[model samples]
Target: MTPRPLPTSPAPHRVVALLRPPQAPFPLACATEVFGDHGPAIPARYAFELCTEHPGPVRTGAGYDMVVTTGLEALERADTVLVPGWHQPPGTEAPPAVVAAIRAAHRGGARVVGLCSGAFLLAAAGLLDGRRAATHWARAAELATRFPQVRVDPAVLYVDHGDVATSAGSAAGVDLCLHLVSSDQGAAYAMRVARQLVMPPHREGCQLQYAELPTSGPVADSLAPLLEWLSGRLDQPVSVAEMAVRSQVSARTLTRRFSEQLGISPGRWLLDRRIAATRALLEETDLSVETIAGRVGLSSAVNLRRRFHEALRTTPAAYRRAFRAERAG
Candidate 1:
């Protein structure tokens, strides 16, 4: 099959999720929410659809059934072909018919995505050869054992290679899907979609899955107030001690709270906020780097550039130019 270009038709780009039973619901839900209809306020850039190998009532492992009306033929028109979390018995290969369809679809030019254990299907299809793929951490070893040709990095959230992509389990699927939207649509638009989903700008795809995350225990209260305070003070240099004082807690206690609730020290959180502010300013304003540095509480433009590169691997000027196009489009 000759590979074609990405979808550029006047119609909305089509996203088709390929499902097999017993299907996991969370990864499917991630794709649906990110690509599904968003009402009149947001222009539809993509059309979300579903298909199955057998095309009938499929058991959702989460205790429900979804009736898929389309068969694998859906792959033919898909701008992006996605396989949501796959859950066959361990060491069991994805059905040969499904594997052939995915391989053919990719060869025919549809971008292929595997979320979570769906990487198993892509591996079976041989799309992951010579590529670093990500899957749920628990299954990483199994995937490596089965497909030594594929470099399996079980730590990252997702990996996108333009033509093919895979994500770690669960919510990381949301990150990869949003990354696609940011690529196909734009960052400004992806930000709007993120707002609708009530999620942070989907984490960077390469972010480690084992990185510290917010804790569920009620050992510490929510940090909403402190975050809000810090957001308003991004223009000023506020030390961690000052933040602790404002929170009415000792610095030691504040540090502990940050670790328990946010999985990072108060200082890291503050610096992240500054970096985020710097990005927003760079993307939205015509301000010079020196001005943006002062606004985000950095000592100099050089410091801002170094930190920006460390975070995103891009300079502020280049990012601004790139996202300016994203925003304008």
Candidate 2:
């Protein structure tokens, strides 16, 4: 009997993860866990590599140096190029050569990702100009000051604008990698990757990092119970008046409480939660768009699509397709 030929249509994805001097190990690990070579037991789809400005050893932030045999030349043919934190001090300029390499890769149609402070490099390279990007909160102000051309949204975990993407610091890098997995393969693939990494399958990048609201002067603990109630009822429309009644407080008092604690209006908080729930369902379930809409308390599929597109910059259908493709691959 003759041996069978391998399938030809689905090519492996090529990802080049750029490693700067004094690189942040966590973000690099996040990229590796998501895309690096795994044995046949793992059902791998990506050919991931770690590349540096020079084909030599690069220092890691963890006080050790690792050899990176690949150089910027690797990015020339990559489907995606990820910068996992620039590793430079806050407010410092990125090297022009590094910036040029990133720009050239992106210009050649490779997707560009800036995980954590890597966003600073992307912005410095002028790729993030007039685009929404994010960075570690501690460096957010500095990034904004240095690159006024880019819109800095420090709160969101990540922002994906097709060819260019950026994420917040630390663990948020995982979210962005998962997002890339989802985008390149599909939700199922992304979920499987997350499972292999032992991480949550889906988290709306826009979800607040901490559920705890900014606290003011001490007051009643009533808001805590109300929040718990809201959390459980995210699927249903939650009105400010209804929340006030449930908390046994006047509408005005409830509004003040939410503003003081959450730093956002109660209505905004409710919408945010609903959107987050929608994201989870979108990335985890095989439900229809209309069904997801109802489950997330949106008015209809139309409303969900509109709001989701506005918030995430891609339609639910497109997002689903990306994840599904990754999984299937």
Candidate 3:
């Protein structure tokens, strides 16, 4: 059957977020919060709507039911099509109709986006083949295992390829939506939307997931005291040798423990923590870059900028500006 032609709309853009049971509510909300009307405070740049495969009461991951009247037919009219998330049981496949509708939408010049587990559906629709995608870290391995043709980067917050995009779990979906707004309009307009939502306007898609941090338990017990001590003393110079000395283990043993417990070496873990602390200072304080560097143990603004850029793919000044704009907005 020939698909319906795209809608001729006077509205600036039409964004349709596709849902399927049991849908993930948070990602769906992320799309809506970004694209939904915010009164005159933020101009209506896009007309956002929701659609489902069967067009009835769809069960959500949160154990509630939401009635959606629109069907996959909505994809035919969308300027941008979003799949918030999909049923995530292992080895499950997207319904053929849903997959076909997504592909048809893309073919008709719609930009398609998948959030979190929704990447699986995009993969099923063959939209993600030969492209880098991002999803929740927990499901990255499964996504890769199931769709070998797709390049899945588990570390990133999101991946945007212009025609298609995918974001990591929950909050990262917000990041992706803000990115879409930025791309569609511009940084200033996107910042306005982000201000309404009380969220940071821009986070580089390449930033590593903070959720990748190690869990605490018996494995981390031996080093827990030292970890706490290090965290409180980020202003002081710290070395692996000092960490080993404090933990009463050899440097090699400390590194082994870190690898076994945290899946990273001691030095790497320390660096990550220092970087994380630096980010907090950047967001919450008005400290000069040099002062922040000294407080975070980086010693110099040049070194802090280099390490911050390496870790987040964005400069501290830019990050601070985005967050400050969010606050001012």
Candidate 4:
């Protein structure tokens, strides 16, 4: 028998999770389960640790104290800083030390993650300012009111800005964690993790179905082939009838399938996809609106601005400026 070579492992990604008093246990578990030990079956990919501002007993709000010995300094060496859930009253501000620590970690190049109410902490750190953030829908109004600078989109399950990420309440944390895994490792490895956790492969954040930067969730279907086709033709003119032709189905049938599976009409989905493309361009490129509009099939800057404002509540130029500032910061 031929000898087999041993598998090689990659560099460990250090994930330091922040623990404030009154932590929400479920979201903490979500982060720990995903980024913590992978057991004997899977090779270790991440180093998971916990920290607090005061570095002592932490309240779980579930009737138990979690004794954490590490302090905010733990974030100094982290590749990623995750705040699972901070259970504070609506108007309360995050501790100055904690906010400063998170801000320092982010400036030091660690990606910051906030799950559920943790978004409030990131906002206090100024990470979510001028960015589209996600949180528990119930608290969305409060978050918006408290942090007027943050663009809170409560309808989405999660929103990832590459450097900073936030998720909706509860299980949505799992989705965002899995998404981070996919982005860090690969879809195949993330799929293995999801299987270990007994979840679907992945689900597109379906609230928007086609919104800008919506996190991954269940891939809608029957329209899968059509969607794949449309992705390639985003730079060209595409109509419902043309899409039906490409899918080899009647326009009515396509519309029906979209409604049944995606909960949106075909036209709406297409427009949203274009808006999404526009947003991506605004973030990544310095392309003019006229150029971007043509690239995304909007045909003109005027039409693109109208649709972009309708979808995102911000003009293309302003969105670009805000994201540029975020990147610069």
Best by TM-score: 3
TM-score of every candidate relative to the true structure: 0.62, 0.62, 0.68, 0.62
What are the per-model numbers of colliding residue pairs? 0, 8, 0, 5
- Model 4: worst 10 consecutive residues (lDDT sum): 208-217
How many Å off is the CA of 13 in candidate 3?
6.7
Q: Which ten residues in a row have the lowest lDDT in candidate 2?
A: 208-217
Q: Can you give the lDDT of residue 109 in candidate 1?
A: 95
Q: Per-residue lDDT for 1-329 in model 4, tens only?
A: 52232234678899999998887899999999999897876678899999998888898979799999999999999999999987667557678888888999999999999999999999999999899999987788789999999999877779988999999988888989999989988887788788889876675553332233332125566667778888778888888999889888999998888887766787888787788888888889988999999999999999999998787666898878867864775
Encode model 3's per-residue lDDT on 154-189: one tens digit a residue. 889999999999999989999999999899878877
Q: What is residue 241's positional error in candidate 2, in angstroms?
A: 33
What overall lDDT goes with each candidate model?
0.84, 0.81, 0.87, 0.84
Residue 55's lDDT in candidate 2: 78
Off by over 4 Å in 4: 1-8, 206-329
RMSD of each: 10.9, 9.1, 7.0, 14.8
Output the better candidate (1/2) by lDDT.
1
Which prediction has more favorable TM-score, 3 or 4?
3
Which candidate achieves the best lDDT against the true structure? 3
How accurate locally is residue 293 in candidate 4, as Cα lDDT from 0 to 100? Answer: 93
lDDT for predicted candidate 2 compared with the true structure: 0.81
Steric clash pairs (candidate 2): 185-325, 185-326, 186-323, 186-324, 186-326, 187-323, 187-324, 189-327
